[model samples]
Target: MQIVVFGLNHNTAPVEIRERLFFAESQAPHLLKTLRDRGIRESAVLSTCNRTEVYFCTDNADSSLAAIKEVLEKHFDVDRRILEGYTYTFRDESSYKHLFLVASGLDSMVVGEPQILGQVKDAYRMAVHSNTTGYLLNKLFHKTFNVAKRVRSETRIGYNPVSISSMAIELSKRIFGELHNRKVLVIGAGEMSETALKHLKKEGLSNIFIINRTFGNAKKLAEDIAGIPYPFESMSDLLGQVDMVLASTGAEKPLIEAGLVLQIMKRRKNRPLFIVDIAMPRDVDPSVNNIENVYLYDIDDLKDLSQKHLSDRLKESELALGIIDGEVAAFSSWLRQSEKNPLIAYVIDKAEAIRVKEFRKASQKLKNADEETIRNIEALTKAIVNKLVHPHVTLIKQDSDREISETIKRLFTPDEEDEKDLDNRNEGQ
Candidate 1:
């Protein structure tokens, strides 16, 4: 089966297109099962805020892609025309290389961001739990993870400020002078909010508040970050109190609207509010960005900041890619060797069977000969058979050269009816 990856990402498609094709975390298992039911033998879905990818092992590439696209259309309630514009497909070696780059963070909008590796691992685990993963995907992902680890350990790819959270904080600092005195409100207790908070706290920002749908989770995160826990009911009321807001909630609809922000701005007396919305569906209304004294940023807004670190990260990425190239070549060689093993075993087994059958026939006609002569004939036949097959066996064992390996495979692969054909030909003659 061929390894294939088909998807769209931040680099290839805009947020609007990505949002249309996104697969929610809860829907992954069902999606994978549906793909498998449609004759996609092995599949995994890696859906994140930046990208949605389906990696699968299938001999029928066209059919597999059609199946995946059908499922995506059904899930998102989008037409095929919409998906056709943004989707990309890769197969075999290209797919392997793409996944390696992805896991190594080389393909992210922000190069060297470390979160994609964890996200990929989580996707792999979900595939495993759903029983959709098989040998090929398992090997590919495990190798991808190893390459990612090597990249992080051997280079400074992740040393630069490449995350959306870091970029948002940097932009805030540029606009507000210092985050130390700025009142920051983090909506939702998700990983993105936590990351933003971590960056803000490191900048000596002490005034922080966390609000979630569940007060218990909000309180727990608040306690961890030493921030105040605001009730979910007071989200609108609290919007006016903070100078900066980072929203990454799991709400389907926007938590903050343009009118809400306009009211909040009136309360703050026209003071500027830097809002960063990092959620997939987007926690803040897009139209709110047009308001005066309201600088709203989404996942796409951080692209310029992410690009600023590209040159430095590119140098580190070169080192990481070199390592991945070597690893991939080594893995390819191992896979080639594995494929040859069964063929070699079949050749040896058939050769031995032929030798045994010939010896038994010869022994039937040796009754008149002495026991010692019979033993001598047997030894001679066995010796001749061993000598005849020695060169072929040696070539199979020493497949270091491509030509010799190919020659051995071509010479020893007996046809299914070769023995019977030989017997029939001999009898006819």
Candidate 2:
């Protein structure tokens, strides 16, 4: 089966197009099942703020891509012309490399961000849980995750922790010119929200409010940041008081609706409120941006700050890319060896059978020969067999086409009918 990836990312499509195509984690299993039912052997769907990729194993990559495009066009209500223009298809070895790059954060909007690795791991686990993957895909993910870990450990890719959270904080600073006394409201007390809170507290932003569905989590995060913990029910009340809102919740639906923001705006006397929604499925309703004096930015909107962060670490990114290249090459070598296993085994079996028969016959003829002499003869014959089989071994190990290996196998496979004919001719003679 061939590996294939068909999808679009931030570079290929704008956020409006991306949002329509985003798949929540809960939706991944159904998408994978549908792809399998449509004849894909194995499938995984990874939809984050920056990308939505469908990685699959299939016999015919071209046909699979065509079918996938149809599903995407219909599912997202996207025009076929636009979808074709925005989507890209990677096939065979490149598909595997693309996944590796993604997991390693080389393909992320924020290069070297640690969150993409977790996102990739989640996608792989979900695919396995759905039974939409088998040996090849499982191996692919394991190798990629290892590569990611290597890149993280061996290089300084994740050293600075320039995550999406950091970028949001930077953007908020750009808007307000300072963060020291800026009143901030952080929703969802999750890791991403905690990350933002860390940056905010480090920047000396003391007036902060933490709200989460789980009160305990919010209380703990508030304690850590030295902020006030409010229940999730008081979000609207806090909205009017805060200058900036960072929402990183797991809510499937938009939590901060336009009407709520409008009410909060009236309560605040039309004071400007900046909102950063870093959740994958977006916590704030995008329509909230329409309200006067309210600005909304989602995860994708953080790309500018991320790009700036990436540029600052281009040297380390180069080192990380070198690591990725080496890992890809290693995986390619393993793949070549795996594909050639059967042919190599068959060749060895044929040579050993002939070698053993010839050795036995020679030993029988030389009845008086000592064991040491027999050992020498056996070594000589083994050397001869090794010389004869060396070319086939080299051919199998190379990155050449499978047809070459098949041709070599055919040469080694004895023709039964020809052998029988030769035996009959010899008897007649």
Candidate 3:
């Protein structure tokens, strides 16, 4: 069997496409079982906010992918065409490399983000509990996790603010010099908002307010993070109360418009406000960036900070790649060595059984001979057979180390039909 990965991610597909194909954490066990029943020997599904990937071990990769696609379509009730364009498939060595990159966080939108490592481990554990894991996948994922750990420890890949939330906080610091004593208003109690709040809290910013459409969620997050919670209806009024505003609400259009900000600024006599908009399609207005004394930074503006961090961590990334390469080579060698064991054993066992049978037949034919003579004859026959087969047997035993073991096995162990054809041709000749 070979390793195969089929999936799409933030780099290849938009969130809308990814969300449609995403397998929830609760659905993984059933999905893994379904894939195993469909002839995928081993399988795992990794569905994060930015990507959805399916890894499997199968001889027929095409059939496996087809089965997966059919399952996804049926489960999500989506048109296959919607995902077909964004989906990518990798097999064998490429699949192995891709998984390593994913675990290493090199494949993330924010290169070197450490969360993917834990996410990957969680997926692997889910697969293990579901009984969808086998030798190949277990070995591959274990190695991948180790590689990620080594990368994180040895490399500076995860040392920077590459995540959207962290980057927003970084931008806020750059504008205001420090986050302490600044009133930061976090709009929406979503995962992104929570992450942003965490980063803000870490920077010694104690003044925080969380506002969500659902009051309970806002209250929950506020209580958990020791921040104040406000109702969504009070967002506009709270806009003028904070120095830094990070908004990631799920509104369709711009929630904080240039006109709204202008009105708010009038109330505060044009005091400087740093606005970090982390939402897609954006919660804050794009034109607000042109407003004087109101610094508005969106996701694109955060790239500069991420790039600088990436440059600083480049050496560590190289070291991580070296580790992954070494692990890949070792795993490949072990797999190749494993393939030769059964073939070599079969050949040696068959040859020994034939030699024993021949020697017994020769001894039965010498019943009239003296006992000493008969024993001498048997000894001589055994010695001759050993001498004749020693070189071949030694070679077969050492086949695990030889590069040409597969070729040698194919030459000696032709299928039964082929061996019969050879015998018939010899007889005709």
User: What are the per-model C-alpha RMSD values against the true structure?
Assistant: 17.1, 16.9, 16.9
Over 1-429, each residue of candidate 2 has an lDDT whose tens digit, in order, gives: 578899899989999888888989998888888788887867888999999999987767788888888877776787998778788888877888899889988888767888899999999989966778754676789899999999889877766545676766666776787888889998999888776677778887868899899999999988987889998898888998989998998999999899888888999999899999989899999989888888898887676656655676666878888888888888888767655464564566567656767787899999999999988998899899889998888878773686996677667768876446434533533
lDDT of each: 0.81, 0.81, 0.79
lDDT of 1 at 309: 73
Highest-scoring model, TM-score: 3
Worst 10-residue lDDT window for candidate 3 reads 344-353
- What TM-score, computed on C-alpha atoms, does each candidate reach? 0.53, 0.52, 0.56
Better of 1 and 2 by TM-score: 1
Task: Write one digit per residue (lDDT tens) for candidate 3, span 296-413.
Answer: 8877777677777878777567777887788778777765663445444334434444555676677788778898997787678758756865666567666555556555545645
Kindly report which residue pairs in candidate 1 clash with one another: none
In model 3, state the lDDT of residue 361.
79
Clashes of each: 0, 0, 0
